[model samples]
Target: MKEFDIIVCGATGYTGQLACEHLARSYGSELRWAMAGRDMAKLRSIQARFEVPSHVQLIEVDITDAAAAASLAERARTILSTAGPFANVGEPLVAACAHNGTDYVDVSGDAVWIRKMLDRYQEVAAGSGARLIFTCGFDSVPSDLGVFFLQELARERFGAPAKTVKGRIRRLVGGLSGGTLASGRASIQAAGADPKIPQLLANPFALVPGFDGPAQPVGNAPVFDPDVKSWVAPFILAGMNAKSVHLSNALLGWSYGKDFTYDEMIMLPGAEDADSAREAADANIWSNVVRALQIDLKPGEGPSEAELAAGSFEMIFVGRTASGQEISTTVTGEGDPYALTPRIVAECAVCLTQDGTTATGGVWTAAAALGEPLRRRLEQRAGMSFSVA
Candidate 1:
């Protein structure tokens, strides 16, 4: 058995600190975990800052060191990484985890990076019984698991899955973190370096290696969706969420159906008319871009606690069958998306360790690998609720 149940690999970093705090405060002596990073002083400082439990060990892990990375993997049942631009700094530890049979999870929303991981380590992880679950954070969890919950209800009530499902971001009330900006910049830089990255990221099925479902609904435009009776705009991560959701569908033996169709959008708060909805959609897009460009924050710094406390969200998922049968679910969060991300990712690692999951030995999505158990953890412990409507 591994010496530790889980290791927070970037425990000194911004989001990493929160992950450590979550585990410490929520699980405490019940979990065997460690905080890992290159600088022991920073780890100690964070431990002090958060008033973390004394028994939780602190270890130095320089993921850039290949041998050290492997050694860290050898000591844990699972590792939850909070390192961002994971495309740049995440591969070494991921490789180590896959080879060492240590389950892994991260708070990355980058589809390009995930696809790269899938291509490189799918077979290795499967062979070693390692599960690399990615995008456990705000980027895709609400959408991924929201859809999972809706489909589950459909199975129970409608006797079949939904062929068409839509994810709407009713309220993604959160502040932009510097680390998130850096990740976006890193992706842009990567795309500049490799032309093919843009092509891959643009593909809706980029996360799925060998299969393409039917063409999806057009989502780039501002329109009033009749399904939900709301005017919707393009969500920046809708494409990423669709990829994760589609990947979940594939991983679950296409239980959602070979012809399953999915898309995501942002619902304008009070756009009662078509023109106003279009304007709001455009404003919403640019406001986010301007905020990102103008925010005077750096990596490891994010919204103030008050700002985070002021944020909340409700993501609505609508699942539809061929005969017009519809079932929907709402994923409601009581705090900032950023605040909730750490809890979600931490629970993912915990779910992998403590929850009895049927998944074995493969790169998996949060929804596919952990499924209902994880949903339960988030609902019960992660300050989130899933309501079937």
Candidate 2:
């Protein structure tokens, strides 16, 4: 028997603390969960601040320590990690869980690092019955599951699967977390330092091995999309989000079709968006992403709670069936995207520990691993809603 139902590693970080708050406020003593990090002092402070139930364990976990990670993995039925640039500290913990049959989830956007995990541990995880779901937060959950939701709707409405799905960022208001920026910088630095890494990062099918689909839309440039009739700017995280969606398709036995194509962009209304405006808009968005990736910030530092509360995003996905029937679905969340991440990821941890999940092991996407059960949980508990548009 596991000692706890869930163990939140890196519970002292910015988003990690929010996850701690959510558990304390939502489940209290009803849940068997732990607040874990490398520092016991910081964990104690969070415990004091949140008044985490006395029964809730607080354990120090240094992901680098193989023995410590194994012990934690063995004791926890589920693990949610809020730490990143996971490429640096995630391997040991992930390996431990995969080897020990403990489910794991993380708000990771690092496709390159995930690719490594897939190569090294996918088989091990499968054999051990560990369902490692990555990008449980805003980066790919909304995108990956958004596509899954649309495709399911397509099957029901059109009697065929969608041949393509275009995800549009209808509205997004939030600051990127310092941890996200740090992850981006680390990825950039690693890519620059290694010649082969850029090739993998640039590939649209980076997460899926042994198969490459048709050429994808060049989501890198701004274009006037007639479908949405808007001047769309390139979304910075589209690369990461799209890969997860593609992996879901692969894992779901190619249900979206082998030639399925998907893309994402930030929508700008066409009323006044001309070539010049699009150019300016693209520069502005990309510059902010570039700045965030280059600027350094401490791991625990980020926008104030008020700022995170001010952030929000809406994603609209349009799925086109081979018969030309189109189905649209919208996913909206309040507060900053990062502000809402803890809720999504926390629910993911809880979802994995529940009675009706984990079909098999291996690195998986939310679409394949959790699906409707997860969707329902997000709708009911995370203040996120999904609706046909």
Candidate 3:
């Protein structure tokens, strides 16, 4: 029996603090969880601010210290991490969890870093019964699970898996965090330093490792789709989400079809009528401009409570079977993506501890590892809803 049901490492970071606040608010005295970080004073500050329960212990565990990380993993059945850039701070904790067989979750959207972690720890995690899950937050969760939900519907209706799925962001109201930008910068820097890193980043099958599926559509450009009757722009997080969805398919024995195809883009209303919409369709271009502006909220800085409450997103997934049968579903969520990420991640930790699948020990996507249990939990506990359109 571990001492804690969950341990939130990097508890002093902005997202970590949010996770703690959500855990405290949602679980209260019910969960036996603790906050762990290198800076005890910052951890204490979070505790004071959130009025964390007295039973919620605070542990000082440096992520870089292998021994301390191992001890921290040993003390918890599951660990939710928010520290980043993950390339710098994520590996040690992942290694510790894999070795100790402790389930782990993180909100990292760094695809390059995630690929490295999977390559290094997948077998170790599988052997040790540790479930290492990444992109549990807004970056991939909505897209990943939305595809899962749509595919399930497709199977039920079409009597076969959808060979192709398109994830389109219908509406999104939110802002990016400084931590997210930092992770992006880190990946960019790494790619600049190593040419092979860029190649891996470009490949949709990078996470699958040696398993390249059929030709995938290049979703990095804007296109007009007659099916959805909208102009679609490249989605910034599509790279990360695509890999996770593909890996989930692979992990589930290609239930979605061996030739399954996936691509994500942001849907802009008023197709061909709005010039500004066409300009906004280039996500990479705007992302670069935003990075140059450096106006994103810093770590521990985010939208006001009112702003977060006002923010929301709705994503539409369209799945097409080989026989041309199509099914669609919508995943809608309330609140700002960053603000609600903590709750999503917290519920993932809880689900991992209490109701995860038996085949859970591996590097997994949130949809593949937690599956319907998490999907239902998000609908019930988190501010998310999934339904057929």
Candidate 4:
């Protein structure tokens, strides 16, 4: 099949633009990549603004057009799709990629959509040798890769895997792109229309591979678990990220231990200090009120150049091995967390193409193919670093 090394679909959108910029800055000379979208004019505009090289093609096609999508799949070894809310408008592109044996990646955190995709496309993908990796961005990448890193640490330190892994966001500060906000609004609206969508969200297995179990109530809102010595909240993206890590466990088999239980939480700053914890609680109350009013505290279309240069976030993954060894690793990165996601998604496509990971294309998640490699790259090139403690 004729192909560019990477094809970034939805490259004209906000997150898509940042992704293209990051890719160009990092791999422009070495990688043959291009910009793509439904609007050729918009794609051309982005190309002109960025001064994209001649080698990078502009493939304009609608994600909804199956035939055109198939043509795109045939033209690119790897495809990074920033088009979403995936539950609404992502399947056709996925189908083309599976059929054409092209590796696919996206920044989707939709559990129900993932489940549907796995059911509909997994077999075709397997036959075609396509790898469809999803949620390779802010929503789940940090957690997925954190799990992988922790498990690797467990093996190296204790000669066995951790029976339980916990990922707590120690601190997060960033703005969301308009695209992400729109996706979330759409998800909320759709959920309001379909009650099941809202209910299924609480189920951890909602997006997990090989999990067809009926839904049940979420166990409990997280509280201070003295065992882990951290206060926790119901993880906003747990349904997506937790399942991804589990799927990786299933696919990679021994990389992540059997009987592994994973959970995520937002660790409010000063959770351990009584005064700071009280202040945090008050802040959370205010934050919820603002969200209720739809006032986005982290306001921005995306990060500024200065923020991209100076912005950073950190997350620590805590692991407890079966042998009682405690391990932790920290992952840090630059740029607005949400804005940085699209770049992560775009880079995933490039990495998958270069790495030549073979998979029977079925629905997949970041943890399955690009998890470890991404962690490495995040450390090396993305102004992100990971280290064991």
CA-lDDT, candidates in order: 0.87, 0.86, 0.85, 0.72
Steric clash pairs (candidate 4): 122-362, 125-361, 126-360, 126-361
Give per-residue CA lDDT, model 3, range 172-203, as digits (tens).
88776778777777788888899998788778
Tens-digit lDDT track of model 1 for 323-353 = 8898888999978888899999999999999
Best lDDT among the predictions, by candidate number: 1
Whole-model alpha-carbon lDDT for candidate 4: 0.72
- What are the per-residue Cα lDDT tens digits for candidate 4 across 333-366? 7776755686677667767877655555676667
- What value does the lDDT take at residue 182 in candidate 2? 82
Off by over 4 Å in 3: 271-276, 282-293
Compared with the true structure, the alpha-carbon lDDT of candidate 2 equals: 0.86
Order of the predicted models by TM-score, top scorer first: 1, 2, 3, 4
- Candidate 2 residue lDDT tens string, 1-389: 88999999989998899889988887888789999998899999999998888888889878778899999999999989987779999988899999999999999889889999999999999999999999999878989888988988888888899998999987888776678878888898899999989899778898989897999988776778877777787788888999999999999999999999999988875336577546555455432467446555677777688988887889889888887888889999988877788988998888888746646888899888889899998888888888999
What candidate 2 gets wrong by more than 4 Å, as runs, is 269-271, 283-288, 294-296
